[model samples]
Target: MTNPIPTEKTPPDEAPRFAELAGQVVVVTGGTRGIGLGIVRLLARSGARLMITGRKAHRLERVADELAKLGAEFETRVSDVADRDASRRLVDETLAAFGTIDALVANAQSYINVKPLLEITPEDFDLVLDTGPRGTLWLMQAVVPAMQARGRGRIVTFGSSMGQTGAPGYGPYSAAKEAVRSLTRTAAREWGRFGITVNCICPASASHRLPTNLDGDDPRARAFAAMYKDHPLGRDGDPLADIAPVVAFLLSDASQYLTGQTLMVDGGGILRA
Candidate 1:
């Protein structure tokens, strides 16, 4: 069975709007497609002012049009989080636009080096590390000053079950994600006194960027596909319905007390405890 990925954003009337999110400002990295796009749609519907970032201009333009239809208050930027200057500028621009960045969805990541650990090159590993942990750290550092000044903020970072469980061919990606999880924990502890909450989510959702092999017929791909089909929920998560709602909760005021935790939003994939 195919996962029913919605092409249209849910109309505001059809979904429950979150009062805590109303007028809040959120910065979502890689908000052009897949899980990032899903997060943006949910936040828009819930009345959050959005600053969405993507590497491609046209992708951001399309998302801008979609949010326009929803009457969403938003701004879009073409940015590569891997670039330190761009990441800093992204946070600065978001704060300038929204006056305060109440939350950050550090959801952008690169997919590369699908080869075995023996065949992986230094470049391949560095690319993933730069795109994942390094990028996440840059944005976090840039945003923290403003958030600290305000004495409150929420940060949601992405991790992966494959990262946690040590997937056979995913050494670099796993390393990067674990590094990001470390960043989340350290930041949460250091900044909690200032009212900042940092958390990580490991999601197993139907995404266009579901690594490189799962769509192929390789043995490892077959194993992963079978695992996805046989998870406790019996299907991969719907990004908007299953994953985004959890992100919304993390961004809400209700989650202020929650920090330094990794939530497996993977519908019972036991790859990680």
Candidate 2:
């Protein structure tokens, strides 16, 4: 009897985890860094045609180059999601580039500002809400019509555990994120009949760390660090391993029955009943 040859396995990093997503078109806001970047990387590798938006031209170019290396077809746009016109333009461009929008990841957000509830000014509230719920609302309006035309779409918006838990120091960000949840629920209800699904992910991912302020002495920074230490997994969520797959699932047909839910992806840091 002849001995059978052993098959070589593809390395985990090189394998496509969601090849079924091949040919799907997706738009990701804030796709240049952190969780957004992670989502883009995964989706690209899964063979999605992507239109990614970022506020920085240089960062968008950098991410574009990286996606090219993955052999992913992508278009880059420099736009702030908070601009309603820009949000509409982004959806139009994505539709123009890919012919249709199958999914959207509303991942762009304003910088987090830690402040006491009493100290959070109206301006602070605006800064968060304007970029979050307001931004997402307009973006949804832009894309939903196309989804309705097709009779199907997926939308995944970012929320936070802080919003659900009502964490004290994250007043403004939490309020903005909670508003997003309300919006997600309402949209899911309204859009369900049109075969569009809306959901939010409250992630405790490490990629939320900002590059500009790596302060060691700040109380807010300390609290941020303490979260990872206290998590059941003993670490923060990795955007690639912990979060992107959930976003991918929400985008895929596998989750067609799911909608209007906020999932906490926080290593058991915040569990909702």
Candidate 3:
């Protein structure tokens, strides 16, 4: 049989929207770039009121400019969610801006080091853990009360398939993501009674490295290109087209009954129930 060409669907600009997401207020961490930015674009088109945060003011401004071109108005703040105070402040600001937060997308993580286990340092673990699971928890804690008050909420946390597959040279990233998975399950169970749903998405996509950032000479360029070269769907996913829709579902009223589950949004590169 001949090989199939990789699919690149919708071009992100044509991302579909769920009707229930209209007018909902959502706080998104690391919304300045990559998959997070894709979520911002989709949710914006879906008419969700966006409260976006990131570490870089310049990139945040760029996001605002891009959204303006699409006629999507949004609020942005420079935030480091790894800091407890910062996480709380993001939620407070979201509430202040939009009155109430309907959903939260914890999509930020700092990958400080990608090296073999034997070469990883204590600092690697610290950086990844602080930004990954710890930051996720802080934001969840800060946002849950608002959801609880409303007796309804949706939380989407990020995880990685490498957390279980133990992909090479990703020691810190793997550990941090696994912790996030644990947090997702626990939060789902505890918050389910309050009409809140917590879910995790493990995505494998090319969104993090946009075409503008690609340099053919980079050592990992080929690796990134080849990630899903032989996949079941024949390609790595486009973050906005493949991943953001799932997130939108989890955020909308349609997914109210689903909780404590991990959805692999990776175009079938790795299958897991």
Candidate 4:
């Protein structure tokens, strides 16, 4: 059996209209590969000066170099988002490199193997919580101060379908992402007075690593595939095509009136209720 490949059709214009992001400084965490990388690519193509952070120095540098060819002013930092000090350093470095941060995409996260709640050790729980929820909180704390000072900013936090529906064997991950959703709402409420917008996206696009995370033979995976088969769009969603534009909209002034909202990009997978 062959693995299903995800695909998307190009928009009619083959170009985005919200070019206001040009000259803006944006930071994206965990941007070395997968969905994060897709966001970085789209944002760069839209002419934002991008600063990306990840734990791997080589991969960060490689991605920075690739984006440079597309006329994006790029910078990279090797930092683990789970570390508060490192997260602060990432923001400081971005400000030092780009002068100001106009938008932030908190996309860094670690996935653990699906196991029974009792099977998960305290250490495993700590690792996921630290990387997903705690990291997001610290990063927001570090950046929002500056954004608030400026009286304008955009923040996009990542959530998951599992987080919304509480899938089995993914307790820790779901819990962490739920916390992210909560944080997003809270930030939007508190920061809106300062002209800052905070929102979360529950992205359901296919990725190379997600299949391995889900047990290949599990009934859950089969159910997911069948849902996609009968999706309203008749295909798996592409992160670049389906997810990136929404993110760009949230980041741009186009979505200035929107905040404290969770947008689902799941090809109607979670809407089968």
Candidate 5:
């Protein structure tokens, strides 16, 4: 069975309007599910042409079809960000389909086996780093030239609160996320002159296992409840409500002056000074 396509929960008359993005083209990695999908849906509503990618062809096609229903102009690629060659090619494929690239959302990531810091192997570290920061670097390098030609671009990368305050049993994943934050800051400074803004978002929106998975009295449910109880907000965020609108802002012209910052959309979970 396929995951159902998401619908805007707001009534047509009450939907929030955003800046025009009719001719803009965006490339979203890992765009088939989770917060990435939420970002894509918002962009679709804004009339942006999109190039969305995922490791699974079936999922990519399913997502593309759903976007088509919204009258979105888009293309889909089945590629892994961990493959440097494929990541570069993804840029080429998007430009081929869309003529130019205006923005990129580097949302692809991998969480390797959760284990204690001492027990984390070199292989595990490599897997997490390779998929997270390494892949983001490759895609950024590939897309920068196009943005330079136009003298403008928007780039959004994913960071995590785990990177700031380390999480137990998530050592390698946390480290990789920190590396991505470093990359985001460095790129923002380097590319600012070229009219590109790079920022990171640390989102605590629901993962695939959301309300349904939170149901029942299993150990997982109890653990999830404990986690939510500690949040500043009583519950976790909904992707469309708590996350994607912020992403949409970063991609819009209004956020032109902001770069190298990490916006924590975690319902105030982690406070940064």
Candidate 6:
């Protein structure tokens, strides 16, 4: 029951055609792997100067080295978003290195095993909320002021399919991501006057974090395959191929009028609002 791989041919006009972000600076949290890595790769290809953050120093260094080889001017910081001070320091360092901030992608998040409400512990709830919701707020607070002074910025946060539909056994994760959605709107409303746009991307894909306990022959994966079987354009999303161009557009001047919206990159899996 293998899921059919999704094809992602770029539309002739939609290919990476934004104004060159040659000197623009971007900070992508959790950029060491998976979806975050996809974003870094695309932004680099578009000539953006990137600064990525991850908790693991070794892994961050490795990713930085690889991006550097691509001739991308980038740096990495080992910082935990949950730590307010550490998050602030990362932003400070980025500004020091690049002299200004243009876009901030708040993508770091932690998800645990799905559990019934009664089985959830305080620690479990806090871990999810702190990273997804609280961390997003703290990171935004740190970067927005600078953007405001400059009178422009783009903040892209990550929400999820689980957050939008409230799927079973994902109570904690759902609650946290829902909070991110709320924050996205609130920040958008507050920052619109400053030429800043805040938005969320609800992405559903086979990222580095695979579901635990799913056998190769498991029905759950089959169920997912079936769910996406009739995608308007059949197949799953390639984080880099499908999502990056959209993000680059949002981060560019062309999307100046779009704000506070939740855009899904789920291969049309969740169609209705």
Show model 2 residue runs off by greater than 4 Å.
1-16, 207-217
For all predicted structures, in order, the TM-scores are 0.90, 0.89, 0.91, 0.90, 0.88, 0.90
Backbone clashes per model, in order?
0, 0, 0, 0, 0, 1
Q: Least accurate stretch of 10 residues (summed lDDT) in model 6?
A: 206-215
Residue-wise lDDT of candidate 6 within 1-273, one digit each (tens)? 344554756642354634567778999999988888878888887789998988889888888788878898998998888999988998899999999999999999987776677899999999999899999999999999899999999999989876876666678988899899999999999999998999999876543444333335453454354445455666556657777777887898888899999998777777632
For model 5, residues 28-108, the per-residue Cα lDDT tens digits are 998998888877887888888999988899888889888888888899998899898998898999888989999999998
* Whole-model lDDT, model 1: 0.84
Q: Which stretches of candidate 6 lie over 4 Å from their true place?
A: 8-19, 207-226
Clashing pairs in 6: 6-235
Give the least accurate 10-residue stretch of model 5, judged by summed lDDT: 1-10
Put down candidate 1 lDDT per residue, 13-68, tens digits, no spaces: 45455777989999999999888998898899989999999989999999999999
For model 3, how does the per-residue alpha-carbon lDDT over 5-43 read when each residue is reduced to its tens digit? Answer: 556567776789877888899999999988998899899
Better of 5 and 6 by TM-score: 6
- When sorted by TM-score, best at the front, the candidate numbers are 3, 4, 1, 6, 2, 5
Clashing pairs in 4: none
Clashing pairs in 5: none
Best by lDDT: 1
lDDT of 5 at 225: 46
Model 1 CA lDDT for position 197:
98
- Over the stretch 1-273, how does candidate 2's per-residue lDDT look in tens digits? 111121332332653468778899999999998889888988988899999999999999999888888788999999888899998888988888889999999999986567788897888888898999999999999999999999999999989887876666888898899999999999999999999999999986454572223245465664555454445655555566667888999998889999999988876767431
Q: How would the candidate models be sorted by lDDT, starting from the highest?
A: 1, 3, 2, 6, 4, 5
CA RMSD of all predictions: 3.5, 7.8, 3.2, 2.8, 4.7, 3.0
Give the runs in model 5 whose Cα sits over 4 Å from its true position.
1-17, 205-227
